[model samples]
Target chain A: MYGGGYIHDDQKKKPEMQAEDPVLLAEFEARIARGEKIEPRDWMPADYRRQLIRMIEQHAHSEIIGALPEGTWITRAPGFRRKLALMAKVQDEVGHAQLLYSAAETLGKSREDMINDLINGKSKYSNVFNYPAKTWADVAVIGFLIDAAAIVNQVANSKGSYGPYCRALERICYEESFHLKQGHSVFVYLATGTPTQRAMVQDALNRWWQPIMHFFGPSDKMSQHTETLMRWKVKMASNDDMRQQFLSMYVPKIWEIGLTLPDPNLKKNPETNQWEFTEPDWNEFYEVIKGNGPCNAERLAVRRASEERGAWVRAALKRADQHYVTPLA
Target chain B: MNIQSLDPRITRLGIDAEEKNPDQTLQREEHWETYQVFHQKKRGEKHSSVGVVHAPNAEMALLFAKEQYARRGETVNLWIVNTRDVLAMNYDDYDVFSTTPEKMYRDPAGYKVNDKIAAYKKAQLDV
Candidate 1:
């Protein structure tokens, strides 16, 4: 009824009419069952297209905004190698954003519209980046833990039903692995360094722990969108399942470095064969998604400023196209 | 050739002098509109045509191609060419040969090369 069509109106159709034009739902189900990738030109259910666009566009927005938090550290990196690595990593995020935006463009949304939506706060990016990067150790935590969480989600998306999105994720996942490794290397160095360095690492970890837990969203039972997404093969795993996978892979490594997670309830349960941890505060996540995060204003301002600054470049390119000519004696 | 009419920046670096007069320069720039992009997946390999990018100039063409085609790490080398320079045969002009029957002799699979090679090897062994 919200979009103008009644949900129960189809029940009034006669049985003879329904039997004549049997819905192609079975064909769509069979296509998913065969593990076939649905290309852009192929026919698909309207909801599947809507879901893919929402997920992919949000992903593109996240990559673009995610660069700002890390871009702040490029000038302050200690050594040449670290500086170069950070710069390259930030550039890669820009490149990844471009790739995803192009994929989303193929789904009927223009890049300009998507970008405008982001700047106007009509859409949302990953809530993790909305948290401030307080110290140098915060950078390492983001690269390691935040990027690690992203890798878990990306790995699942690499096998998604959409052909171009799947192909794009394959390359993105490879680059994310490098970012995770670099972050982990920095954390390991700090963890084994002086008392102050260890303390910095611990403090950063404490601030990030809650956001990392909330990264995967609420439990599967609570998510209304999860069932339809799963049935359409757009999402292969539930949010809670992916969160547990992240914990299983990361908890031991955190413990090995002799650092404590902020959550007091975090432990390995032998009976369930899973890591038991405190649930993240959903209210905070809700607030962040509603544009109430600490860095939301700053992030939007930076993006808008950059867009304004680059207007001259686009104008120059356009003008050169019309008036360009060869020189003569 | 009216060089003074164009933007001063275009003429500042003497890039315009490398070409012919104004008309020829304009013609060449117009001719250079189509660009073919080649991507080298690995070092020391021949570049292959991945796609084409269009622009008004060579520099912008290459930049556009890089953004449009080679953001991923699969490319090591890229070649951009003007589409005007490429010579292609027209299908409409080749009607005499277009409907010809399949030529099995041109295919190795149709000739049973494996059996023939096996027979040759057997002959050599006998010898």
Candidate 2:
């Protein structure tokens, strides 16, 4: 649920290297064509491994980073019920990170390297979390709207080719469904409770609207060529399509609840059956990815401090002479 | 990371985990391998993997998982399974696990007994 649609497409394709083994590549591709899931020991093209690693590493990074914005509110949650639920939700996010990191490890990258890359600003996460959560109502908006958006993405990705990640996501999506319910409950309380409470929720939604739209990334016309990735089931659904699907499903629900979207242009087109809306600013998205967002510095600083503080415990618990057992699918 | 892959002597380098010795043997790899956590909320129920935990050993993993996952629930039994010990086949072989559509023979719905039952009732009434 932590992932967004902004896929970083910077992996340089080595056509020559992959072309060296056409027969094996064809066999690998044939398996994929037959709706076969790829295992860690499966004979896949080098680029496939690289692309999967990059995507999964980014996803794992997003889960942990995404926790930061929500984790801050645990202590400030209004009541015991809200506090307990928020703490569990945040812990679930961190557990997802742990699961995702393991799934990525099946591709050969260690969790340490991924964290280092994230902390050193050499990697990316979801663009939405860079914005600050300015109010308690922001928590509601994140829990309901943001989580709803992630379900759309993760449910699609759960049918992906990688066995480990798909399994991890299957469990994750189950937990997220409960999260959505919890979030919806909180949102309904705010939206229907009091005049001030209603205003707070509306104001929070207004602020979060742009980031939510940007969550799905740029348009398909502006997208990178993903034909091969799609055929391989690496990229399950396109960003624009996911965005359209999210809007069609959630916009009416928002209105039915007596809340409104910030974008007036957000509506479904009858003829094309596409939801039409003003595109979010890709320039700001790219800028935020470059580490200039409102909370990026603070986020990384906190992560750095945590790693240092937890170093001793990790050291004290270290063991030697281990065996690498193949993980279950 | 699996510490078993390292030579046993590697532990002698120092307590400092960040030791950057020139010899590769002295290097330490941080991050524990993932262990899947399963909890049975009540006795006699099947255990299900609720989440994952990372720790140096299985005992520690169980403890960590108990604290992180079991606190909010009524857990009666907890199981910590190393992801490595779980053997997963390729998803291309997924048909082995599917029991839908063509597998109606395994369910009571597969039987069509309405007509037979009606004939049996009529025969009984006549007798």
Model 1: per-residue lDDT, tens digit, A102-129? 5675576656667777777766778887
Candidate 2 docking quality: incorrect, acceptable, medium or high: incorrect
CAPRI rating of model 1: incorrect
lDDT of 2 by residue, B1-127 (tens): 2112021222222234332222221113566666878889898899987766767899988998887567554889899988777766775576776756678888888899999999999999999
Residue B48, model 1: lDDT of 78
Off by over 4 Å in 1: A1-25, A222-225, A319-329, B1-38, B43-58, B64-76, B79-127
Clashes of each: 1, 7
User: What are the per-residue Cα lDDT tens digits for candidate 2 across A26-134?
Assistant: 8888888998788877778787887788888888888898887886677678999998998888888887887787788778876777877776677788888888777
Candidate 2 residues lying further than 4 Å off, grouped into runs, are: A11-17, A221-225, A322-329, B1-28, B34-52, B67-76, B81-127
lDDT of 1 by residue, B1-127 (tens): 2122122322232332223221111122222234666778899899876544535567887897788667556777778876556665543354677555466667665676788899999999999
For candidate 1, the per-residue lDDT at B39 reads 74
Residue A95 CA displacement from its true place in model 2, Å: 0.7
